[model samples]
Structures are given as structure tokens and as C-alpha cells.
Target: MTPSLLEALHWSTMDISGAEYRGKEVPLLVVPTRYLLKLDTTMISYCDMQRVLFEEEKSAYNQAMQQNICDGKIHPLTSIHHTSTYNSLCKLMEYCLSPAVTTLQDRLKENELRLSMLQEEAKQLEADTQNMRNGSPRRLMNHGAGGKSSPTAQSRHPFSNQGSPRSPSGGSRRRAC
Candidate 1:
């Protein structure tokens, strides 16, 4: 019935090979309503064919699974070493996180070192202040000054006893009581 319908639609015989279809004219059945219905029918048939093929494929797959099980094929769970997409994602996350972790560790270490150096400087400052409070004679020297000394120039100099012109007439002159 379908063949006859197709034949009735159009038929043209040509004496020349590779002839342009423009010169040829066959009786074209331009039933707009019927053509639309036919197109819909073809779509429906194609969908049905796809459905049957898919069902057959599912059944064949199930049979193959049963056969594999009977033949002592590797267990699905044990055979697969990795099926978790999460594991790969976690590995990628870790790979991305490692640099940040290392950077944080380095920054922490550097901060600790800076804190230690600051602590040492604070201790030295405290010791210096304590030394100043204790009235240590060397404190003035540390303060960049000549420490508490006598006003006499003769005693302050080592060459005062050598009788130099810069010394007084006496070898040394002591302050009056």
C-alpha cells in the first residue's frame, strides 16, 4: 500500500544521465493537509522504531550482565578502583590548596621570627634602662659621654706627671678640702 502511494506521487523517466530535475515534471500530489499528516506519521513511526531499538538494547545489556555474573566476572564494586568523581575533585582541591597551605606556613614562620627578634630588642632595651637606674658608672660611657670625673686637667691626663707645658707648676694639685 505504501509503495503504491509513493508511485502515485511522482514518476519521471529520462533518456539523459545526470539531467537537471528543472526540465522534468511529474504529477506532484500537493495535498497540503495529507502531506502534513504524512510528515507527522513519519515522525511518530521513527519515534516508535527508536523506542523498540532502545528496549532491545537494554534487554541485550541485561543478558550480558547476567552472563558475566554466571561466568565469574570481576565484581563491579571490587573491580572498579575509582568510581568517585568526588575523589578526583578532592584531589584537585588539594592540589589547589597546597600552595596556600605552604604560603601560610611560611608566613607564620616569618612572623614568629620577627616576633622573636622584637622580643630580643625589647629585652636589651629593658636591660639598658635597668643599668641606667642602677647608677652604673659605665652608663655615661654607653650614653656617649665622659663619665663622672674630676675637674682637674692634671689628673685626667696620663702625661701630667711628665712635667709637660700643659700641666700645672706642681706635679699634681689636689682640690682643697
Candidate 2:
């Protein structure tokens, strides 16, 4: 039944060999509508082809369907296409994300370093203030007379003291004989 149906196919204008050449006539293989419906009841077949075959002639559905029908085989191409697409998408994602990851790591390290430096500066300022309150400076310069500093030398006002002790009244405290 299948061989007879397939063998009966013929061109309405020309045939399958001349399908590439296009002018006015649509290249179509003419077959009985009953044979095509019985042989190609399912969606994907020679009958379902857009312009390859013509299956809309005389309707003889019930008589043609009574015979044994053999269907065409199909192969899917999605697996090949999807594998390549997955690889490309993965590469694109890595390319887009690399710079942000590097920048985030660098900024975190910089933040830690800056915080430690600020803590060390605070400790130094605390020590300097303690020294000022204790009536001493952080360092003392040596004079020609001696490198040894008197205990009371830095006890006066840091800006006003001239190495002499003066009474609070701004004069000598001794009485005249």
C-alpha cells in the first residue's frame, strides 16, 4: 500500500528534480488527497511539506485509510545547537562579571588598610595630648650649655617661658633692706 502510494506521485507542472528553479509555477507533486490523508494523517510528513507536494485533490479519506500506512522518520537538531549555545553563554557571563569581582576585592583591601592607618594616627594623637597635660613636650632640643633639661624648664607656658622663674605679680618677691 505504501509503495503503491509513493510510486503514484507525479508533478503537476514539472517534478521534484527541478524544485530549485522558480518562475511562476509553484513546484508541487500531485497525489490523491485520500492516499496522502491515509499515509500522512500525522502532522509531519511529505503531505505536510509547504510547497514540496500537493495533497488537496479529490477527498477519498475513508477508503485510503483502510489500508496499512507507513510514516516517514524524523531526526532532531536541538542537541547540537544547544551545546554550542550553552558554551557561548557561559563565556559571555564570565566576561561580563570578571571586572566587578576584581574591583570588589581591591576596594575591600583598600578599606582595611585605610582603617588600620586611621587607628594608628588616633593612638599617636592620644599619646601627644597626654604628654602636653603632663607639662612636657614630645621632644626636647639640646642647647650649647647642656643636653640635660631641667625638670621645671618645660613646666612654664610653652610659648612664654624664657628660662627664668618670675613671681605671679611680675616682679622680684624679696624686700629691700
Measured by lDDT, the strongest candidate is 1
Instruction: Report the C-alpha lDDT of model 1 over 4-74, residue by residue, as the tens digit.
Output: 77675545333344575676668877766865776446655755665565566557555655655746775
Model 2: which residue pairs collide? none
Backbone clash total for model 2 is: 0
Candidate number with greatest TM-score:
1
Lowest lDDT block of 10, candidate 2: 50-59
In order of listing, the candidates' clash counts read 0, 0
**Per-residue lDDT for 123-143 in model 2, tens only?**
755754665676544242222
Question: CA shift at 162, candidate 2, in angstroms?
Answer: 17
Assess each prediction's global lDDT (C-alpha) against the native. 0.55, 0.48
- Candidate 1: lDDT of 89? 47
Error of 2 at 38 (Å): 71
